[model samples]
Target: MDHPASSRAGVIVSAPGRRASLRLSYANAAAWGLGNGLVSSTLVIYLGLELGAKNTALAAALILSAPQFLGLLRFSAPALIDRLADRKTFCVGCYAASALLLLLLPWAAAPGRLATPERSLVAMVAIWSLYHLLEYLGTVTLWSWLADLVPGRIRGAFIGHRERWLLVGTIVGMVATGIGTYLWRSHIENSATWNPGDRWLGYAAYALLGALAMLAATIPLMRMATVTTTASRPADHVRRRLAELLAPLGDARYWHLLLFGCTIAFFNGLTQSIQFLYPAAVLGLSLFAMLTLRSTMRLGQIAISPTMGRLADRFGNRPVMIACQAIVATGPAFYLLATSQAPWFVAGAWLAWIAYAGLNVCLPNLMIKLATPHLRAAYIAAYFAITGLTYGLATVVGGWLVDTFRDERFYAFGTTQIWGIYDLMFFLGWIGRTGSVVLLFMVIEPGAKPLSQLLRGEPQDATK
Candidate 1:
């Protein structure tokens, strides 16, 4: 691979020193966690516990899954960035715009009430969709920029270290939000006529803080190195650019990778709509308990990130990713077995995060490795775009499924009655997630060792 600063045309974009680049990357990653954790971590819980949305599943589909429906915009960002040739500016602008948009959530609720009427919910969805659209544009550029700043030789460590920073920020953010919500809930638990809209005030405050964090993170983003090579620049010919955009559709390997990604996205979307709902509505977990459950998962990711990164570096992303899927496949079965408020359920949830650490570290790197340098943005765009469309539809369908079976149950295991719809969906998700492993082998990385060699503990060169 070419050096971080130089491109195929032998042009040298002014580069930040390695230490500075890593520092900036770390800061940016932390900022992302802090800002996102505040809004996204407890969004579904807030909807039910605070906002009192009529249908939590549908609300989640609209607010959380709405981003995926905008995936085509992400696919086009690379070409847009190519023409602009100024990734840093675009990324910083996105951070600013998202920060401003987040303040509108509280307003999405009905006047003086915590509930989001359908009209307000639609407006909220539109705002969130716009926010995510900008975020996607920034992400395409940011990943491309990072790929340029960090050399291929140490990319694994770089991504691993970056994830570590992200975890730290996420943990802190979650804790802060958790504590704030907990105290607020305690004061109002017994109050008569305590308007649910009151909680939106607190969330609005939290969201503002998150928005500021995003702005703060942009400072470091602005300081990062800029790539301005002729090679990095997009083709001026509109016809040529259009042709390149559709070129990935013809590559067998790209299709294989895309298929694997879509499988994961579909199941993830299918389960994500109800991850909080199952615990709250089915398991009857309190807010504190939910916090503990989520914390366990995040903590597991933190502990295993460095090790997973090293494994990916020593072996290859493909093998590590396959192992991750296998580990995650068994997680849903544990949830199925949780019949009460037992410690085992928490323990079961933690198992999935152990696998998530590996997946989180490997998948992005794999996307980068799968594409040529100049075409990296285009490939990433396509990968996200395809997965986005699949997940977007899945989330809505999953939400509808939940409402359909909210009061239904069927006898299973000879006397135990399971929530018929959710249980069935969980089993299907397990199958889909596990089945995705089959397609991983079909993806060919240029310098990666074969799966057979990897399992035999043989080291293969990955110095592409």
Candidate 2:
């Protein structure tokens, strides 16, 4: 039996207040984020650079066409999550399969005798694509549970606290990854004591570990599940609210929002694509150094998150998002200005976190608030699908730009021709985001205020 609004909804720890719930959520997020970072940041690089795959091949791998895949998955979600049942079991099953796919990565990385270089690389990409699709579906399903469990009022602070801890774990994981890279430069695995294939093999092990971590965290959540089939009065009003809420998307507000949001999505994706390349190629930094950068930036989020969360709750989600967008949109442009100075790394890393933590804390909260509870999961999925598909389009365009130019980004010394490509992405994305910011002001609804505000922010007589 699922109790939709109980604070204890499937949460393992039997406790009260904001702090305890925050801890429980953080544990869950850390496990999920670590697994995701490993797959997204490293998978493409492991293919193109390590396996020697070419530009177009890499683009296809990057595309993976996940957005379209989820559109079909969306149809089945209602029954599986809301109607048919067994969402938890389904999530566990998906994780198990994903872990299995991960273990194959090391074997695929091995130069094979049966398959040609191209064929082996293609097979590996296919495996990774399948893994991502499964993971994405599982994630959407899992996220639905969180939305059902957490109340609307504290969502911002709740998620912020959760991300703070997760960022800490992410830092640890990133540091470990950097160590693996540094060791790879030598004849040994993560250190001088191992063999050449140790790096990828060890990574496969990390993937398995990630799945196990998710299970560990989820069990705590599931421990709190109801033993009997519980029922609720159907939320008919919620449905009515959704129809009204989504109506704005059909008007000018929708285009304005989509254009701006997609722009932010595109530049963010571009940075993501080039991120692995920068550490290994441009900075002349060892994999370890890159990890250090990732860790340092993420660590900063610990302080930034609480501040950002409360500010969003106190002021508004829009202004906080604008502040974040500025840091992110303008951040990349700083790279071209950076010389061989030591502070360059510090500057870029700060800009990166401003975007990273802000988005993580705000976007999910904003989406949840904007949509009605009945439609929350579906709306969130739709949001993810749009952003992800846009991400695919952006990555493809960037890849083409990189390829058509012969991958020779530099025409002059002290100038980053390729870096300029990345900068233009941010410049345009900022304009796009600014447009969305403008829309938020128009469609802003007072009813979306946090739960804590219910007593103060609402009309007092209505409370009676």
- The candidate scoring highest on TM-score is 1
Q: Clash pairs of candidate 2?
A: 1-230, 153-451, 260-432
Clashing pairs in 1: 114-197
Q: Write the per-residue lDDT of candidate 2 for residues 1-464, one digit (tens) a residue.
A: 32333533333322243334445557766766565544434534543355545664234426344333443454344445544456666655565576567656556656552266666666666666666666666666666556655555656677788778777667666666556545555645446476554445544455445545544545443443322224343567456445533543554533444555666666655555544554455555555565566677788887788777776666556656766765655555454454345425435744465566777787777666655444556656666667777776666565565456534444333664544454454445445544444544443433444434543653211100
RMSD of each: 2.9, 6.2
Give the lDDT of residue 290 in candidate 2. Answer: 56
Candidate 1 least-lDDT 10 residues: 2-11
Cα deviation of 294, candidate 1, in Å: 2.3
Model 1, residue 179: what's the lDDT?
76
Q: lDDT per model, in order?
A: 0.73, 0.55
In lDDT terms, which candidate is top? 1
lDDT of 1 by residue, 1-464 (tens): 33345453333454445458679889988998887767664553454345455777777766657878886788777667656747778778877787777667656643434333556667667777877888888888788778876767778878888998888777777677777766776666657867655665655666667767766777788877665555544346687677667877867778888888888889878876776677777777665566656666777888888888888888988888888888887766777666565635645855675678888888888878877676677887888888998898888888888887877888765777555777777777778877888888787766788778887998647674
